[model samples]
Target: MKKIFGLLLVVLAVFAIASCVSEPAPKKDSPLDATVAYPPKILEHKGTAWGANPPAWLMEALKGYKFVERMADYQGKIVVIVEQDGESREGAELAASRLDAIPRISTLMGLRVKDTFAGAQVGDKDKIETYMERVVKVASETRFSGFMMEDSWWTYLQTYTPEGKADKRTYRVIQLWTMSKAALEKQLDSILKGEAANEPKTPEKERAIQAVQNAFYEGF
Candidate 1:
């Protein structure tokens, strides 16, 4: 049977601001490392994630965060989850990092969606059931471009005290746009009608197309 409907797909990878751990206070013979705190301060903080009220800060911090699937209100386009690369250097510079991130992430994302979506027709429309394989290609042809930011959180290999520091950098969740259900269905319909796919496959098309397929059943 020909399955037709709208759907949103996403890839969820947890990331956090990078931090590292430190050693105890310095010994008489060895000085403490500059990156590590000379003296450590411990906290008595004890908290549970559930069964109780969450702090105001936690609530506030998560206020704008939403799964890409929930943001259909922004536009009819399908949402593709992507990871925005964040760089950690000698200093913290969000502005510059974001600039570098756009193109870098876009290139990596292109490799993912280069093929878009595809569909195959099987059985006759009069048959009780039908099977099909489908492929949908967008960005290269329809100018599928641009992306939105999604929720981001910290990730750590191991837990640490408050002052712990690590070499990891902050990572972000990127919301990439693809064709909407109506739009994707239209692609399949065109295929069924024996019509040509989207035209003028652009030489530069990656930022938009790669995401939808990997996250979706036929998107790869």
Candidate 2:
């Protein structure tokens, strides 16, 4: 009877071990696991996006105004956004000449104009959209990193024109700003370095803009 009792005790101990082995261990929190959603690296980009627009006529008329034959070292990587709205040739010429006269406008501000342009016609319906798309395309095709559409001229014309269509023309022009993206990395680098930090941050975007304010100021 003693031997049989000892054997039964041994059998119970084995069964107990087996039951513990079948159950899974609880999962513990890992320190590294919590930060899986964080981005691998931060991208610091320059914020201010300078813009310029020529009349529609010159934008369409001028051959290479839309293209960047040689990329200038203006405002670091702050992309220069230029719009050649070539609707009116004569007006476009006047605008371009005036814009060119403003020293450092192209280099520091990153905005330039080749000329003034005529507003899109009412009967054409899709003229403004088509023209703006072309402007965006030209900028990209020429490897320009950013874009800006100035409908200031268009607004003036619409004031005298009939309702509905006046606002219609300007809406597409406004939409261009959202559609464009420019790199300001180079410009940001210049401003963040030294004296450029002293400038006021009026436009929130300009807060991050770092570069020579104009061509005259030399940044060390």
Candidate 3:
């Protein structure tokens, strides 16, 4: 009886040790669950803005790359920047594929900014300035010149309840502003040179410039 009791105690001790051994926490389905210093900011413009954390698979794919910054909701459109070290067409293609695997991400445009620019540290003033400077400097380099601004818009039907009655509304508006690195440089130069005022403008163009500025200075 004593030997049997000792055996049971040994088994319990083994179980206790097993329980104490920590396993890595399971990755969350949503990227929002992952801890980030600067959480995603609201993409303020018009219409309802919807944002969510990236999935576990995305997080894994983004590993070894520069960083998977927060996803933004620009008036119902989603935008994300996946920066990678060096310039690899193959790598970018693979990354694009990974991003496309996500349904929401696939719908929007993906801009690939290559080489030597790490995202600024959260709340670091000098780091932020340095990062932006580097981005601009890189932009100025003639070798990096695939920047273009795409003015693409789409409308969708939104259902809502008004006074207990179901109603549907169709929104017709330009929802996203995606700029290439070259285009971004041009806009930034225009803004810095006090030329944005001189250029013929629309509300959407103004917002796009502001959004790009904010993305650099404040992070997505």
Per-model TM values vs. the true structure:
0.29, 0.17, 0.21
Q: Which regions in candidate 3 have their CA more than 4 angstroms from the true location?
A: 1-153, 156-158, 162-164, 174-176, 186-220
Tell me which of candidates 1 and 2 scores higher on lDDT.
Answer: 1
- Please write out the lDDT profile of model 1 over residues 109-174, one tens digit for every residue: 343333332221222212211111222222223322344443332211222243453333332223
Instruction: Residues 51-113, candidate 2: write the lDDT tens digits.
Output: 223333223222322322122312232222222222343454345334421222333233221
In terms of TM-score, the best-performing candidate is 1
lDDT ranking of the models = 3, 1, 2
lDDT of 3: 0.31
Q: What is the C-alpha lDDT profile of model 3 across 1-220, one tens digit per residue?
A: 3322322232223223321222223344556655422211122212223322323323322331123222332222223322211133344334433432233222221123212223533233332333344444433432322322222222222223422232443322221223343444464454333533543466655654344455543332
Arranged by TM-score, best first? 1, 3, 2
Best by lDDT: 3
Number of the candidate with higher TM-score, 1 or 2: 1
Give candidate 2 misplaced runs (Cα > 4 Å): 1-87, 99-220
Query: Against the unseen true structure, what C-alpha lDDT does each candidate score?
Result: 0.30, 0.26, 0.31
